[model samples]
Target: MSHATTSIAAEQDGPADIALSEFFDGHPVATFAIDTAHVVTHWNRACEQLLGWTKADMVGTANHWQAFYPRPRPLLADVIIAGAAGLESELERLYPGKHRRSALIPDAYEVEEFFPNIGASGHWLHFTAAPLRDGNGRVVGAIETLRDVTERRVAENALRRAHDNLEHVVDKRTGQLADINAKLQEDIAQRLLAEAELRRSNLELTELNQQLSRAQQQLLQADKLASIGQLAAGVAHEINNPIGYIFSNFRTLQNYLDQLFGMLDAYQRAEPSLAAPDAATLRALRERIDLDFLRQDIPTLMAESGEGIVRVRHIVQDLKDFSRVDANQEWVWADLHRGIDSTLNIVSNEVKYKADVVKEYGAIPDIQCLPLQINQVVMNLIVNAAHAIGDERGRITVRTGRDGDDHVWLEIGDNGSGIAPETVSRIFDPFFTTKAIGKGTGLGLSLAYGIVQKHSGRIDVDTALGQGTRFRVRLPIRHGAATEDPTA
Candidate 1:
């Protein structure tokens, strides 16, 4: 009803009704009331503000549904007036899942729904309606309250969408991580296989290297024996010449001694028999014995014998130096020239027959090396030089010098037929030779090359046809020293 009609009804009901009307108008909630006939009885100030229809226009009219819906329909208050018999079914029909019984008020129902005509866009509102009954418990009218919940509903929907998007992102990332883990596992497996294969190859290579080392040592021993045999034969021949002459001298000396003793015995017998010592007999004996000649020749024989002994001693000393028989293959500082000289002595028999040795020694420092091995290098080069000479007598030049400050070098050159171009390349290869079988084992140059390499040195050959060949060996002054082109 309008305010004037409400005032008129209040006047009829007395002061208590007036207080009730004032209370309804002053309430904060947007509320409206309906009569038993479904006519609008009261529209509070809050309801007028919410629906944009003043109490002056809505009170006493049955058009309250116009505020929330597009056409005339029962409001929540009308639904309550339909009575409790089919109340739940009626609420289910109107609001579906949005309606429920009020938790705080008996015989009251609540619903939250969107009303398109309630605002500029729309509004979500939660509204509750309860019955107003008479003293006899008969339904007389109903009161409805509304609350705007648009902002809360919008925020809840945004949060739900965010939660769904987060779930999708987490699932996608988990799948990607699984794929990466599989790839990494496969890579590890492949790497393990590769490592195992590499280890097997290394073990095989180590065994092969050990076998090759044994073979190389055997070859070296064989070469040394061959060279020794050749040296022994030559040394015997050289020593025999001196020994034969010395033996002949000893026989002659014995004869001279016997004749002298016979003459002395006769003199002694005559001295005892004759007063004048028989001078003529003595003279005859002296003339027969050739005393003056014996005197001169005996001293000469002794000198020659001593010289032969000295030669023998020197040969033995040279052999000792060349072989280093007492040495334990240790690195030591030694005179390269001294080693070269001893090597020359040992191999002299090989070279002397075919070549005249010319020594060109230079002032050089001692070097650190395995002395016996160095001697082997010199021996090999000299032997090779001797072999290079042809039928005609040749000159073998042995040269030694310092190369800069860090290295020393020795060159053995022969004035024989030079090495062939094809033969030069394989000269240092084991068992490769130009000599006839039984003459050369061909390990001389190869062993020499290996020794020089072990000393961190180098060997180079220079040759021209008929002009002869020169083999130069350069060695570091200090054992294990870094190597460079010393000639450069």
Candidate 2:
């Protein structure tokens, strides 16, 4: 369909085709219509806009297959036209079960399939095709409409990955959970037996209320444990990737060591032998073994392996510091910058792939606080920033500075999608998440809020939709409560 030919056809088309063309041109979705002979009668403006084929190139032609496929195969629209004429048996062989009859429409079919030749690469389309009939109720042709559903497909895949990760962690912890359950049952049995003691009757009422309180605490702790279980898997993976290569390098070094040792043994034996091998034989051995390459590479390989071990150890230490594994949970004078650094290291795996982290540090005084708990708050903020950025390359800027003489402040900002104004207030509310299921526990900000509050600090949010978000945490330079309550 050349441009000049389409212009002539538009001028000669019947009133009915003109009216249909008018309707399809302004339609909201990508649409096209063809006549009984499979010749394209109308290619809408939206069709041209979406499929990159101008009306001049598509109208008055039956080459619709070129827009979607490499060869002339019957499209879903063709299937609809054929099926409407009772050619169901052949369509079965043509398309198999790749498409389905539209449950909501009569004599229509819908399909969600990948169009490999569309756009820059492949694109997923959600489209439906229906027979276009005339006043006498005969099939005149077929009209097809479609839209790109690639973003929805991406979200579905992320949800699936999240679900799989959660399931994997649950399966790995099944044994630990079973052991805990067995021990819990034994504890209950022993306590019940102890309740039968003659002196226990006096405190039974108090014990019941206490047990109820403990049950609530246990539930709270269970959530914490679940969070920990999830973190453990990610941390394990972060450690494992480097360790895997490190161990592999070391194994290769071991083989190299054996080879070198064998060469050394040969040299030692030759030195004591009355009839040592001639120079050519030794030269051949060295060349066959590639001694020159080994001399240069062995140290380099060992050095790289050593660096890998250092990396693994540093990550392990950061995890320990972030989790307060071996440190007291008491409030103390702590370096805020160091705390932030450790927290960033702890969640490095989470952020590294999502965005580039930029640290903007300034001079600030150490504050009296629960350092590890503060690190937890920092981790939550950093992770939230990472997740808020959609699946595109983004940047997160972390800044630390002084706020007057009494307070110090830190900011975590992202140049990704920001929060909506209406939902900003409710963001701190527990269990309110914008993320899809299985990706968040929704306790991140809530926990961060509580932790900051305990430190007598406040979290202020600055955000604009589609621009970005920055969360600022301001704490007093020092607190007087350090001596009053050690745990605080």
Candidate 3:
């Protein structure tokens, strides 16, 4: 025992070695020592905090294994004092591959393991143990230090799972993309025959559109209505032939698709009787393309496309109807509601972002006046209402009602910045405008005023600053001689 004096055994002596005991107890790392007999000699303050076992209970007992394991077993420090012959055998039975020789300490061993009995929830511990030698270099005891590495272990496991999941997703997507690329190559080869014809058609259409644009620019110098009329008429005449063939081709495509789907159905029914390799190949292709979903979605897509083409046709027709004021100025019986709707459709781009439009129409008879001129009047009023709106979103309301039996009235109003009294008096004067430069020509209200007068009608305005403005046009049921300008 005299050889144990210079080792950790010095701390086990009575009051004479109190300073040595205090020094070992003051260490920050969880540490404990065991003699050659496997008896606990020291347990530090950090070890007490780590396992909730006081130094008094642990310092003189061999029950240290109780803090880490359910049943008593030799801990790393106990194994370290067993001499080299028994040390390797004991570690192989307990720690196995988790033990490794410490890189920084000669003949010291380090191990990491999950100790289920360490706390309420288990903890992962990394501990190192080394033999304590006397002056003659004979092993008399062993000292072990411990660290809790539970958090690091948890993070490592999570990162491993995430990496594995990402690799699986990448492999699945790669297989799917390879299959689709093969199918796409086959489709592209078959469609190459039609690509040349489609390109030729596109080139012809582009040249025709350029010619029409030049014609439209020349006509714009004549007047607004004339330019619109020329463009609409030219587009309708030139584009309708192409649209007609396109619509017809869609029908032809539908028929071809029906025949192809019929052939595919027949092939599917005969698949079970085919050779094993052929059946497997067919099944793989169908899985790659998700053929069942495409079978359900293709008809829906075709129907939507057909509806879009029909809507385009109606839009072109509306354009022609809207621009007929200068093309045909004849007075004709027409539905005022229809005219208003067409006018709104033409100017929708101006008002959609600025304000929401609400229409309240009353049942009224057809008016015998120029349809295009009335549409023009409605467009001008609606455009003015939209321009009066400030930065915030606003509302524009259009109302129509029969004004007795011989006349009908149309009112367009907005929740916007109202016209000033001074400016209101001159709003209908040609070239008179309070608008910013390039935003207005100021002829819109003037043209509307003259058109109303031509139909022997009257235009009235009601407005207030910061509230809103309303313009009402009252027109005769039938066209008549020119009337005196009462509001002039």
Best by TM-score: 3
In the range 1-488, model 2's lDDT, one tens digit per residue, is 33354456567876865786788888989998776667777788888877889999987778988999889988877776664455576566766776777898888877788887888878889989898775788776788899989889889989999999999999889978999888888799776777687457757868987667545544564456346645754676678777778778787877888798688767846754534466567767878988768767977877787787778867766665566533345678888888788788878889999999999999998898877668877888999999888889899999999988888889999988999889888887768898889988777887777667667788888999998999998888777532221113
Model 1 agreement with the true structure over 1-488: per-residue lDDT tens digits: 33465556667887876576688889998998887678887899999888888888887788888898888888899999878788888888888888888999999989999888987999899999999876798777899999989999989889999999999999999999999988888799788999999999999999999669746864665467456645754676677676767767777876787788688667656765665457667667778989668767976877787777778867766776676644556788888888889888877888888989999999999999988888888988888888888999999999989999998888889988898898878888778998998999887887777778778899999999899999898998998798554222
Candidate 2 global CA lDDT score? 0.78
| Candidate 3: tens digits of C-alpha lDDT, residues 335-407 | 8988888788889999999999999999899999877778888999999999999999999999999988788
| Winning model by lDDT | 3
Off by over 4 Å in 2: 1-276, 481-488
TM-score of candidate 2 to 2 decimals: 0.47
Model 1 residue runs over 4 Å out of place are 1-211, 222-277, 483-488
Comparing 1 and 3 by lDDT, which wins?
3
Which pairs clash in model 1?
1-41, 1-60
For model 1 the TM-score comes to: 0.48
The Cα local distance difference test for each model comes to: 0.82, 0.78, 0.84
RMSD of each: 37.7, 22.9, 30.0
Q: 1 or 2, which is superior by lDDT? A: 1
Worst 10 residues of 1 by lDDT: 1-10
Would you give me the overall lDDT of model 3?
Answer: 0.84
Candidate 3: minimum summed lDDT over ten consecutive residues — where? 213-222
